[model samples]
Target: MLKLLIAVIFFAILLSLAAGAGFLIRDQSPSTRLLTSLKTRILLTALLMVLLVYGFSQGALGT
Candidate 1:
């Protein structure tokens, strides 16, 4: 269940990144969209890292 939740969250973050990329390409001049996306991505990456670490420590992931 935890693994599934993690996977879902991870994919959602990836989709957000793709959307951000699309926005960056479509929008022109002084847009906060790109910066917002970058910050979101960074924060999501950190969360993912923490999830992985917790999963491993709990023996929910890895051999």
Candidate 2:
């Protein structure tokens, strides 16, 4: 369980970093671009949360 949490956290951080890079390169003067960044964050966060929950529940975290 502990390891599962650790892996989940690490994965989340990596995903967040990738999204951050994409966000940084996006347009700087458009509200649509801003929304795109927000959308990416939300999607990644949700994906990580779901993956963590599923992994912990199924005891497949590190397998």
Candidate 3:
């Protein structure tokens, strides 16, 4: 379950990255879509890091 959550968050980050790229290529004027995607990615990444640290501390990850 925890691993599944980690994978989901990781994939969400990837999706956000793709959205940012699409926004960069499709948007001509200054827009917030890219920025929003960036913020989402950053938050997801932070969540992932926190989950990883928690997993390691709980002996749920690593050897």
Report, for every candidate in turn, its global Cα lDDT versus the true structure.
0.87, 0.68, 0.96
Task: Report the C-alpha lDDT of model 2 over 12-60, residue by residue, as the tens digit.
Answer: 6677667767766874765465466567667767766787787779887
Candidate 1 — worst ten consecutive residues by lDDT sum?
Answer: 1-10
| Candidate 1 total steric clashes | 0
Candidate 3: residue 7 Cα off by (Å): 0.2
Ranking by lDDT: 3, 1, 2
Q: How far in Å is the alpha carbon of 30 misplaced in model 3?
A: 1.6
Give the root-mean-square deviation of each candidate in angstroms: 1.1, 5.6, 0.5
Model 1's lDDT to the true fold? 0.87
Sorted on TM-score, highest at the top, how do the candidates line up? 3, 1, 2
Instruction: Give the better candidate number (1 or 3) by TM-score.
Output: 3
In candidate 1, stretches whose alpha carbon ends up further than 4 angstroms from where it belongs are none
Number of clashing residue pairs, candidate 3: 0
Q: Each model's TM-score, in the order given? A: 0.87, 0.51, 0.97
Question: Alpha-carbon error at 7 in model 2, in Å?
Answer: 7.7
Worst window of 10 by summed lDDT in candidate 2: 29-38
Clashes of each: 0, 0, 0
The runs of at least 3 residues in candidate 2 whose Cα sits more than 4 Å from the true structure, single-residue gaps closed, are 1-28
